[model samples]
Target: GAGVSQSPSNKVTEKGKDVELRCDPISGHTALYWYRQSLGQGLEFLIYFQGNSAPDKSGLPSDRFSAERTGGSVSTLTIQRTQQEDSAVYLCASSLVAAYTDTQYFGPGTRLTVL
Candidate 1:
């Protein structure tokens, strides 16, 4: 059984470049989430997807950040006109259910570095 996984373990981009991070959730998991973590900072929820419902984007920092989950499986997080402040580790997690008490499995994350 595979857990959540992300691609491009590391990314380096200029201050104004855009980047897309990908995630693959475990099989049969119905809930997926995106988070961002800065150095020495805790994980900050960015978006969430449950089944076929609309994603929760309230945690997105600004208009430059967005995400989408396709077929209730794979998810992608895109950052437009990236800024230095956006440099951090982008993490993905998936759970069996959408409840707050459900157990979530996390991916290794993609480290984004803005120069």
Candidate 2:
């Protein structure tokens, strides 16, 4: 795919269940970002991986959420204990450079539902 791609376009999970959302950034992109937004809320930054260095996880909402980028390309977001509040649209974006000024290409996002 030319653009960022996310798996399980929609997910329905029970409370306390774990969920793994996958994201494949554009080829050759050096930066990948993860974000989630609840209904009527703005996108909330979750994590980001730049190159082979450490990811900035400052934006994560809690310890239950974590993400990793393998081979500097594919990325996965893991939610340890799903909660109703965790329901949101998980979005992935990639940019050639990891900078605020770089244009980010975004995926359609994975819609999560918790019950």
Candidate 3:
């Protein structure tokens, strides 16, 4: 594909369960980002990866949430001990670089529902 792609466009999980979301950024793009959108709130930056190295993971809500980029390409977000508050739209974005330039191209997003 020419743009960012995400797996499991929608997910439904029970509280206390675990879920893993995947994202595949555009080829050659070294900068990738994860964002969460909850009701009434704008996109919340979850993490950012610059060439397989996450320089800023401070956006992650808690230790239960984690992400990793491999080979500077594919990335995965894992949420353990799922909570209802964790249910939201998970978005993935990518760009040439993520310093101060480059527009981020976002995927369709995966709507997670934690019941």
List the candidate 1 regions with Cα displacement exceeding 4 Å: none
Quick one: best lDDT, which candidate? 3
Among the numbered candidates, top TM-score falls to 3
TM-score of each: 0.96, 0.96, 0.97
Model 3 residue 9 lDDT? 100
lDDT, candidate 1, 16-87, per-residue tens: 998999999999999998899999999999888897564577999999998888898899899999999999
**Candidate lDDT (C-alpha), each:** 0.92, 0.92, 0.96
Q: Candidate 2 residues 33-94, lDDT tens each? A: 99998999999998888975545889999999988888999999999989999999999999
Q: List the residue pairs that clash in candidate 2.
A: none
Q: What is residue 13's positional error in candidate 1, in angstroms?
A: 0.6
Worst 10 residues of 3 by lDDT: 94-103
lDDT of 3 by residue, 47-73 (tens): 999998999999999999999999999
Worst 10 residues of 1 by lDDT: 48-57
Q: Can you tell me which runs of candidate 2 are displaced by over 4 Å?
A: none
Please give the lDDT score for candidate 3: 0.96
Clashes per model (N, Cα, C within 3 A): 0, 0, 0
